[model samples]
Target: MSSVRRLRPVWADATPDPAGRPVQLSLDELGTPLAEVTFVVVDLETTGGTPAECAITEIGAVKVRGGEVLGEFQTLVDPGGPVPAFIQVLTGITTTMLIGAPPIEEVLPSFLEFSRGTVLVAHNAPFDVGFLKAAAARTGHAWPGNKVVDTVRLARRVVTRDEAPNHKLSTLANLFHATVTPNHRALSDARATVDVLHALLSRLAPLGITHLEDLATATDPVPEDVRRKRTLADGLPDGPGVYLFRGPGDEVLYVGTSTTSLRQRVRSYFTSAEKRGRMIEMVRVAQRVDPIPCATPLEARVRELRLIAAHSPRYNRRSRFPERMPWVRLTSEPYPRLSVVREVKAGDGATYIGPFSSAATAQLAVEALHETFPIRQCTRKLPLVAAPGASACVLVEMGKCGAPCTGHQGPGAYAEVVDRVRHAMVADAAPVVEAHADRIAWLVAQERFEEAATVRDRLGGFLRGASRAQRFAPLATCAELVAARRSDDGGWELVLVRFGRLAGTARVDRRTDPRPAIATLQSTGEQVEPGVAPATAAHPEETDLILAWLGKPGVRLVAVDVPWACPVRSAEGLGDPATAVAALVRPRLAPDDGAPVVRLPGAGTERELDIAEARPVTLELDDARVIPFSIRPPRTA
Candidate 1:
């Protein structure tokens, strides 16, 4: 079928270029009087549900500025097909009525011209906007990207469900005593929607939503009580900082940091657009906003982590349970055993591996290590003299332990095994990884597929945990480090890191030299001893926080007091474990020339699989005998 011909406008056009015209006002100018803003409320009656299968039967719209109607546009369009019986009965538009009407090709261009330079409003807007975009595409016209607001969503925020049974246009119209009643005809519905729009906007005025941009996010869930606290942000300085919301009892409710203006970020919580229910509740209960200004964004982030750790705020989820975080440590005994601990004690003489997210992950890493080396897994205090009646554990009988508790294994032999475990946890994980690879291969060959997969996942998890521990270990050992990043405003953000904690931070303006500021901060910073307990030094969470910031774009390592490096070769070479596992479990597809295909569970249709381009296979572990070794580029400073 030939495409429909494009039609040029016959009327004199005075519309400006939508792209060149400025729509967003500056934050300072956002208080522009709402009466000057224009709105175009639109409604459409369609033949079906979605744009692809539907055609618009009629269009109706009204333009208003500041609550007063300026103009109206209405039209009937011929869909060029028989109207469905149900649609005709619902819309009262039959094939006979549309016989003499103009086609959509003529109706759409005029409607676009009428609605130009105005924010479009509709009840559940996506349906009308989708149909308009589809009609424009079919008729060879570019769909103008216009700002839109949904009245249904707005009504839900302004009028509570208890006040109005539902947010339907008719229900809202009756509840608000609208000027026009909705009867489902295009014009009546559009007019009713306009009334609903005004009612919602009137309610929004008290909530400090006067700007056009504010209308778009008005449906966000801010409680009525929280809206009154908008003045809490009145005198906050516009800079990078951490903000704490305090409850009535002076307890911290939530903690957050912003690189932009602290005033702007905290003020957003009082608006209807803040939709996180937990945050909304936190804001509602908050009696004051406490702003802790920082010299740089990095400092703000570090302070936020420290504050969250200190207060363990009810609304702060992460970095709040540092005491509960698991640490993988070797016990201090004649025959040391690996154990997951909640705290690292002073003078334990034990080599520590992690402050892992959970005990389960730390235990998994320990189990993977035990599988490779015959280490003592029993918990006992073995002395130079053995107990008279002590017997070996079952693990020792099964050849999994060295029986060090019963003195069957000498200190020299057990010491060698302990050294191997320490090396695997600290420097190299190759031995454990190779052992797991061999076991997985043997299981696969014996047709024990499930067991093989389980062992493979365990090995992956251990490698990931070990690699992470190694990356952060240097921070704990370093005496001092200095890092810098170029801020968006052309300033240098200098970070003074002592051991693993952020000691100090300062922002050096581009107009001035940064050397003096950096030197001053570094000289006055706190001294941190290597391998100190977290209670005495900076929390482990601070190290992770700094590492994450250093990984972001525009950050650079300017200087370091000591050298640091990640391993050049290790299990990290296998790449991300999740990605590797996904490749193994993903269903394979047969050749596409109408061959019968067996559908695997969770796999897409055969056509979808056929259309997908083949990805180059990397580190595939299908052959159990092949061990993948990764040579990573060493990161040094």
Candidate 2:
């Protein structure tokens, strides 16, 4: 394809190639600015194809400033309804997954905050960027107007087409020999893209793609005004509430919120003559401005929280310790028990709190509630286990106990205390809702229709929030119970549960076996029984060699372990010294022309599959079983 036809003229000043076709530049030829530009690597998993037609299921993006990882943001969005089965499987996001998640209206703001003030980077820029634009348009916010770098195009420029058979993310990962953890997860994939960027940069270093601005402009154009606006946003409100700035091309220079009056505060940046230069420059980039009026101070606080958590404006601070936050999770048992744990273990049950840093912090909170509510912390499993003869133990001796452990307190009485403790933990929501409802009722009775309508809105918001919290509590617990990323003596392990049952586990094995094969190789260079069919006239070799032994007997899982040593001295010049083998047995293998058949453990049936895709292939019967296989790539010179 010609360069002119490949490049789309999306910008006003975009010039066509010499042939009047779109131009597609390679990494080596494309201009990159090393200084004065920041890049935001982004990825998103959604409900359907088009952003207008579907909703975002998950979003993960990282900001890079000065070629270093400056910040990151990731969240599982509540797309608000059932996600298709294929999408759920592809993204690992289920309909049950986002039940109580905050809606897009709230989530978009947090996303913006992370993406603000930088050029976007993605594998296929049009796909991700288009979706984002559509999402912004759907919401009340203006579509994001920023430059984007498509890594797919960059990869094509960095190496010969033959070097990478297909330019998929997986293929590039293999080419770079990149170590990507949690492969399908949004964060892990984004990290891999970043690595690819660095590798491509090294290859294209001589192409004048070194500077930040040059690279940014080379990939996509950024109007000069957007830069000035960002410069002047430095003094704006740091509190939670919305702020809107207009720029060129219906450009939403920034959509954000501050905990304080960000608008009044932002304008103060232009009060001085010296600051006017920067303010004027920002205004030149922007075209309009607006703000939504907030009712209560608490509502303002929450709105700011929603915006920061959503838009992640350029000036907003990145999350300090998102995974360290505490959350409550319900155990996957007959009677679900709540326990406190950290966000890193979000998929684990046992309601979490603090993601609070220390046990003392969590304990202090429990104690504060205990002082007011008199709730028992003792185990209900063996209520009398605490004391030998007495009805109650030391807890009763102290003023802190309601004495439920010994049955001294009835279930009804204990329940009341438990309710109070729960309130202390999350703060009571009922009272707030009831108060708002009461105010609305008074307004209605007084016939103040407009005021009543306003009060009704407040009440509706509170009720809706309560409903979401209830739904989320259960769904969050379910997710926690069904999946978990754990660490064992061997290495890392991922557990998958089904309907609260431990279904399977995927683990990495670091050990390798050393042995040689006693299995036979046919005279015509294939593994088969003698005289089953007419043999080939030519035979490459009849020698016997051994390969590694690996297995995962617990589940339909894939486990790969690097081979310890080469099985044969003759198979040396094949490139990688360590070989890999994989095995999958199900639904019996179909008849094929050249595939080798491997017998099942019980001699029940046979299965045919690729040796390369198999992690463990059975070719021998020894304890340190070694499978004989060729390590040669067919000669084509």
Which candidate leads in lDDT? 1
Best by TM-score: 1
Worst 10 residues of 2 by lDDT: 540-549
Taking the tens digit of each residue's C-alpha lDDT, what string does model 2 give over 113-136?
A: 667767888988888888888878
Candidate 1 local distance difference test against the native:
0.72
Give the alpha carbon lDDT tens digit for every residue of 1-637 in model 1. 0111111111111122354322222123333344567778899998899899889999989887655577888888899898899988988888899898999999988999988888888999999998999999999999888899988887777788689888888898898778789987898898888777766776766666655645655676556577667667766777889999999999998999998778778878877657788998887788888999998877888789989988989888886877787877777778888888887787889877667778888888788777888887766567855677778888876678878777788888888999988888777776776676556434533445567567766776677667667767677667788888887779888888877788888888789788898889889887766665322256666777787887789888878876777676544454544334332332334333443332222223222122123321222343332222222221110
lDDT of candidates 1 onward, in order: 0.72, 0.45
Clashing residue pairs in candidate 1 are 220-272
